[model samples]
Target chain A: MDIGQTLYWIGLAGCAVFAISGALAAAEKQHDIMSFILLGVVTGIGGGTVRDLILDRPVFWLVDPLYLEVCIAAAGLTFFAARKIKFKHKALVWMDAAGMALFSIMAAQISQQWHASWMVAMVMAMITASFGGIIRDVLLDQMPVVLEPEIYVSASLLGALGYLLTCSFQGVEDGSANYLALAIGFSIAFSVRGAAIIWDLRLPKFPPPAAE
Target chain B: MDIGQTLYWIGLAGCAVFAISGALAAAEKQHDIMSFILLGVVTGIGGGTVRDLILDRPVFWLVDPLYLEVCIAAAGLTFFAARKIKFKHKALVWMDAAGMALFSIMAAQISQQWHASWMVAMVMAMITASFGGIIRDVLLDQMPVVLEPEIYVSASLLGALGYLLTCSFQGVEDGSANYLALAIGFSIAFSVRGAAIIWDLRLPKFPPPAAE
Candidate 1:
């Protein structure tokens, strides 16, 4: 398949994974189906929507609402199937990790295509990968995992950095090397996030103020 | 003043008020100055940024960064002055109300100018007024006031509806009636919100499911 087709599938998979993860999270709240659907769609689209806005590009879902359709379908499916699923929390974390990995690389690629500086690309990648889950957590009134002492955003940042470095070294010729970069970036993000989840890795916390 | 100039001033005032309100909210967390600035700016711009993205307009801050400058300045001022302010919570609520009042009307007007349907305008106004505070609360790990069964989004919706109704009746010729519409819409939103704050009004909550 051509690079564009491959990226398109990756983007679709990312959206579906994020949507399912959102539904899984919402399930813990025992919210109604409508709420499940709302949360799912928001989680799926939130990251990319922000990235597009910042880059002044047409919103991805708006440009091709198939993405939205996919999220809604995924949410509906999860709503019914979630009852049968054991280990939901673990499933949610794993799905979220996959979504983060996929989205970070896709966003970094888009940012590079838009000719954004590496710094901007990295930031955009982090936003694209993490903002969806952040929105879900915020709406659910849970502390956002990114704000937790976790390695989530760090993993995304590393993934984006890895992708940019690969692109820089391999030259941006839009060839097979692009696929290699995507694989490397995705592997870095997923592995880091997976390890963090397994080991319960945490970032250092700020020391309490001296007076406190 | 011309209607355009008047609306411009109102928009700027809205940004500043929201920024101050954000800093006040962040103060309760005892975060660092940088966190204060981050929260303030996000709260000031979050709503309108979403609106612009949805409406396919150049983001206001991106097009003219003066709005960002205003938010940063307001945040900085609030950080230094917050300790001396009596009734910090009350001050935050009032500032937030003012921002909501101003931004709702401004967003409705913009939506109308963009030829959005009245329904779309109302929804956009709600988003523009409420999303900023929602974002601030999310970041601070507090329940968003809008989702607390308060009359926040309702007030914003009413403000936008009032503005649209006035525009329809008064004609959209950009005349003195436009000023009157702005005043009427602002008063409606502010009074509704003020009354809610004073009375501690709340929307009815859904009953718990039978099993629970």
Candidate 2:
């Protein structure tokens, strides 16, 4: 498959993974099935939706049915399987990292395809990787992970920036470069996030104001 | 000014109002100036941004600096003034209602200008009115007002639908129709919200699930 098609499929896999996490979140809230589907769809496509919106392009899910189908199916599957799932928190964090890495790389590459500046590409990468979870957290009335002390946003930022800078050679074909960037970016981001999950890596909190 | 220009100016006013409300929300949390500015910008343009995104159009703030400028000014002004202001809770609700009404009506009209279906227009109306507050509440880690015990989302929906239906007369010119619709929609929405604030109008919550 071409780079575009590969990103498309990989992005769908990311969506499914994100949808699973969203469904799991809704399950934690003890929300009904409809809420599960809603959260799943929102988390699955929310980032790409934000990206497409900013780029003046058609929203991916609205333009195509497949993404929504995958998200819904994932939500349904997760909802049913959640009862039997062990170590749910650990599973969730790892799956979320996988989805974030996949989405961030794809978003950065696609933004580059749109001829966006690297800054815009980085912002799109962060949004694509994090906005869905943000939306899910908002709906569930919980603090979003992106705003928490985890290394998630920084990981996505570094992954997108590093991938772009490292793959700037003119001689390399676009398709191969894209795949290489995706692999390298995903590896770097997933590793950082996995470290955060395992080691409780965090940005230091601000000290309280001195006697106000 | 023509209908389009009138709507543009009114929308900017709405942005400022929303920005002020966002700043007020940040003040309630005693967040830093940066958080205040972030919330202000997000709340000021967030609803319209969502509308543009869903419609596959360029983001409003990204396309025009005016929106961002207003949001920043409001945020900065409110940040400095917030300490002097007391009894803020009452003022916050009124200002929020105003912003919601203005945004809802303007969004409905703009959606119609894009030749969107009435259903799409209504949805846009709701998004444009409520999403900002949702963002603000999420940032503050509170239950969003739209989902809270108040006649919020339904008020926007009714106002948009009522205004469009009422303005669909053969003799009215397009400009007059838009103005009339805006007035009618804003009035309808604002009145419902005002009553809700005064009377604590709310959708009846489902009684806690009986023993699971």
State the displacement of the C-alpha of residue B192, model 1, in Å, after optimal TM-score superposition: 7.6
Worst 10 residues of 2 chain A by lDDT: A203-212
Which interface RMSD values do the candidates have, in the order shown? 5.4, 5.2
Residue B27 of model 1 has an lDDT of 75
Q: Pick the candidate with the highest TM-score.
A: 2
Pairs in clash, predicted candidate 1: none
lDDT of each: 0.84, 0.80
Tens digits of per-residue lDDT for model 1, A1-212? 88778888889999999999999998988988988899999999999998887779889999999999999999999999999999999999999999999999888888777666665567568779988998999889887766555578778978888888888787782323388789999999999999999999765332223323
Against the true structure, what is model 1's DockQ? Answer: 0.13
Tens-digit lDDT string for candidate 2 (B115-153): 778888889999999999988887678889888868999
* Model 1 lDDT per residue over B60-143, tens place: 875556777798789877777787788989999999999999999888888877878888888999999999998888787877
